[model samples]
Target chain A: MDRKMSPETRSALEKLADWFRARSIWMLHYCTGCGAVELPPSMTSRFDMERFGIGPMATPRQADVLLITGYLATKTLRRVIYTYEQMQTPKYVIGFGSCTINGGIYYDSYNVITRLDLYLPVDIYIAGCMPRPEAILTAFNKLREMIEKGEANGWKRYEENKEWYRANQLKALNGEVYVTR
Target chain B: MNLKELISELKNKYRVLDEKFNDPNHTFVSIVPDQLHAALGELKSYGWKHLSTISCVDWIDDNEFELVYHLWNWDSRSQISLKTRISRSNPHFPTIMHIFPTAKYYERDIHEFFGVEFDGNSEMEPLFLEFWDDIPPMRKDFDPLKYSREKFGERDYKVPFADFIVEEGDQK
Candidate 1:
């Protein structure tokens, strides 16, 4: 007996899944740089990010979002790749501050990487040296909106362009990052 | 013994090339590389018991490497910087671990950054910089900008307008 559901019913179920995913987002509590200073206020009663169902998770296994807070040195980038690979699918990456966009003040630094998008797929970027708590909340709201509309699909893009990202990672990290999975 | 007596005793005992008193509490004594071990041991016996740190500087033009060992006397609050120079091409200095056992990590740090071989220190392995392939970065001749550009590429931008707009007065 064929137990396949109708196309309309499948689409409705997917819409419900997107709605749940957009509401509850568990961000990894990993601070890469100085940009992490703003997160305390955002998570506290002053801004109250929990009302929107976004909270910090201790482990990447339960996290839906990975926030690259600031500039990533060559050594840290390897660890960041390992962390990103450990995350389950449907994961989203938010590149915080101008450091992830270009290199910010560390443009000419020998150890700091210039661009983050070359290695990982970034869904949205918050532009500032160190964005305030309000800006961070605004970015979270925008990310929720994107998820609701099914527009933020960086995880899918990562799977499709795995080889290209791997090449860029090897080039920057001197072929040291080993992805166990 | 006071600073004056200490300086005279060091001069009479070891090969003290030059001595300069920065202030009453601080002093710098330059010595040959061969006399570093003996001088440091004597200084330790003279109540300068603390070996604060060991720092290295690359004198590229002179083709020499200057190693400064800062020793502190807690009793009198006086500090002495024992300085020594070794040939840049063949930089090797005996490890001061016998006199100051804490110098093992400092020697490893100097070896990692400046490429100076500290004899008798078996653990000269890299303290930092994982999988470092190029020359020592702290050396003056190693261009950091070139290395960064070659390994990690720069970002490209396409301007919507002209490359440069020159004002009438600013034009050469």
Candidate 2:
């Protein structure tokens, strides 16, 4: 006899897959620099953010999408990392603009951090000094599809390195290294 | 509410204004420091909730410095860039954080970078450059190249490299 599928088990598996495929997301409005200017238009009537079932979430705890807009000065980096950590399971990150990728015109900037990935995991990057509203909407649709496909596992990564991530978080929270010796 | 109407109103109100600069989507008004608050208040009455940033340009050759206040007005869907000038001797201005809460942070950043003090921003504190002071390097009068030359002490590293290659050639 073939061993693969029981009738009840197959139905449950199909439902679970559908649930993952319908994941609608909410983005946190966190912009540390110029790239933030694009969000207003993108989410407003110009791009009609509601069309894709994605909208801005004011707090990280309840959101799935964390859109980091631009230039993270060391001071701002701390706050950004804290916000990322606060985000609940199934979270995602969209790095917006050239500054979020490689710091753009601010590449030689002394105060801005050169790479955002050093601080948090980034799933999608929108490339531009300031990406157009259309580009942002496109990026959002892509992220939604990835989420539905279960390609982005925001919580699993956090679970794998909870301690290491906690240490990095603590260093920003207080001056101590946050490692248990 | 839009840049065109706002520009028209500002032109009518302020006497020290200069020629305006308009790009495809941005409009800037240049005014003396004394007129900045009044002009900004005009925008605030509309729906300008955000003070995007304060950019400073030091033009020593021209004997003046330019401060541009980039404001984001959500309702109008445009950035109203306001310009102001101050004497190089002692650049000072009233903090507009009273009108826009966000200005406080941008003002602090500008205060450290350009050494322009905001009179009413009590929360103004250094957010960068932990401990060190000379003239504000971003100031128009502050010559970073001169400072680099003086601090690093002029030296020719290429000459030594060339001499090393010449000696290697001689050996060969």
Q: Quantify all predictions' global Cα lDDT against the true fold.
A: 0.88, 0.70
- Writing each residue's lDDT as its tens digit, candidate 1 over A1-181 gives 1212233443777778989999999998458889999999999989999999999998889999999999999888888888888999789999999888888888877778888888998888898999998999999999998888777778877888889888999888877777343
* Candidate 1 local lDDT, B133-155, one digit each (tens): 78888998898788877877777
Scored by lDDT, model 1 comes in at 0.88
Colliding residue pairs in candidate 1: none
Residue B164 C-alpha lDDT in model 1: 89
Q: List ranges where model 1 is wrong by over 4 Å.
A: A1-10, A179-181, B158-172
Superposition error at B165 for model 1 (Å): 12
Best by TM-score: 1
The ten-residue window of minimal lDDT in model 1 chain B covers B157-166
- Estimate the TM-score of every prediction: 0.89, 0.48
What docking grade does candidate 2 earn? incorrect
Clash pairs detected, candidate 2? none
